[model samples]
Target: MIELKALNKLHISSFYKWLNDSESIRYSLSAFQKTNSPDEVDVWFQSVLEDTKGLNLGIFLRDSEQLIGFTGICKISRLNKSGEYFIFIGDKSQWNKGIGCEVTRLVLKIAFCEKGLNRLMLTVSEPNIGGLKAYQKAGFTPEGKLRQACFRDGAYHDKIIMSILKNEYLKSVKA
Candidate 1:
């Protein structure tokens, strides 16, 4: 679980740890080479705080404010009423515990209800079968796969485009 708060400068160390984890980095699509200097993190935090188009939520453990993962909407277009998205559970040991699903569901509530966005869209690599199922359970319908969009681990993987409209999400929630 996570609480959306103002991005802080001190959180960089934890973010860096998350980014360094291979499992987490696999989902993040960000390149990190061993370390991110404090100055760089400071700048990054400043930008995240100044982010007006979308939101980044620092995921935490409810019992402890331990930063476990991150979930957010990007490419937020108020005029277009849409956004692209990503989620990362940094600690690989936590992957199969339903925490990722819980975090995603919470964010989706913010997207469709709080933000009043008409649609939410996300992409998952073809090999990420578990992620695909989780998104499906969250009411995202597969739009199709982009062939060879991701090149990682000496292989190419398709990216699956999935989206859930406000009406669709509402219906799923009700059902």
Candidate 2:
């Protein structure tokens, strides 16, 4: 099982490492193409901690209490009642284990139930098949695509936009 708690300084080092990891950051739209410096991670971490519009959580294993990755909603707009959702599983060993899907569900619950958001959305690169599959499994439907929006791996990739509204989420959880 997976649970999300407020991200703290204790998880900063692992978060830094994950941000710098080539394999992990490859799919992130906001991540720089190169490894980030420790100072950069510190600055970003502080911003995340201070940002009231965002909810940055550390993803942990329920039993072992191990920090594996980070997940949250950012660019939150209260007037719009919308936010962009994101997740990164830093523990590469834990990939392909359905952890992403479980975390997605947990985040959705927080967004709609706790935070009272109307819509949650995400963007995935075309090459990120695994991540795309996980989001789809979490009940996000593809809304649109940005052609050649992301440049990665020596080529440009399209960004697939997906979203789930509050009503859709309520219906899903009820079924």
Candidate 3:
């Protein structure tokens, strides 16, 4: 029902809006900072376009081709064959529909099968129950927790660190 593709300039406005959405930022590190303006979003987009070590993809509805969200494997280390995973469903209406889990699997295939990465990791704020579930469902195992790693809503919260290795991914797909 959804697919991933390269993001373009046409998605700038939506990206800007999502970054500024209070609800969307509730579990995101973006709550600690500010996106400020469309120009800032454009600058960030340009950097994503030029980053050879990263892959930023737009999440779209396969039926209508609407851009609903975005996901990425960032800071890819060639030496270690690892990267940080991140995703945002900008369209609030699409939440809690198992889309996050679907997108996570798609990115895992790209990270392990295509990119030849050995490990993909992510940190989900404790309050982000949806993200935690999605990642776990997609085969990421919790490695540890970072105590008070993120501050939001006037309180510090723990972050759950999760990861899936190349071997784990291969076994999961085969099963």
State TM-scores per candidate.
0.88, 0.94, 0.94
Candidate 2 TM-score to native: 0.94
Q: Could you tell me the lDDT of residue 52 within candidate 3?
A: 74
Off by over 4 Å in 2: 32-35
Highest lDDT scorer: 2
After best superposition, candidate 2 residue 26: deviation in angstroms? 0.7
* CA lDDT scores, all candidates in order: 0.77, 0.87, 0.87
Please write out the lDDT profile of model 1 over residues 61-149, one tens digit for every residue: 77778777667898888887888777877767677989878887887888889888888899998898899999998888999989998
State the weakest 10-residue window (summed lDDT) of model 2. Answer: 26-35
Cα lDDT tens digits, model 3, 1-175, are: 9999998777777777787777876786553246647777778777777777789999999999999988899879999999999998989988988899889999999999999999999999988887888889899999999999987879999999999999999999999
Q: Candidates sorted by TM-score, descending order?
A: 2, 3, 1
Candidate 1 pairs with clashing backbones: none
Q: Assess candidate 3 and give its lDDT.
A: 0.87
Q: How far off is model 1, as Cα RMSD?
A: 2.3
lDDT of 1 at 88: 73
lDDT per residue (tens digit) for residues 13-130 in model 2: 8877787778878887475455499888888878878878789898999999899988899999999999999998988888888899899999999999999999999999989998
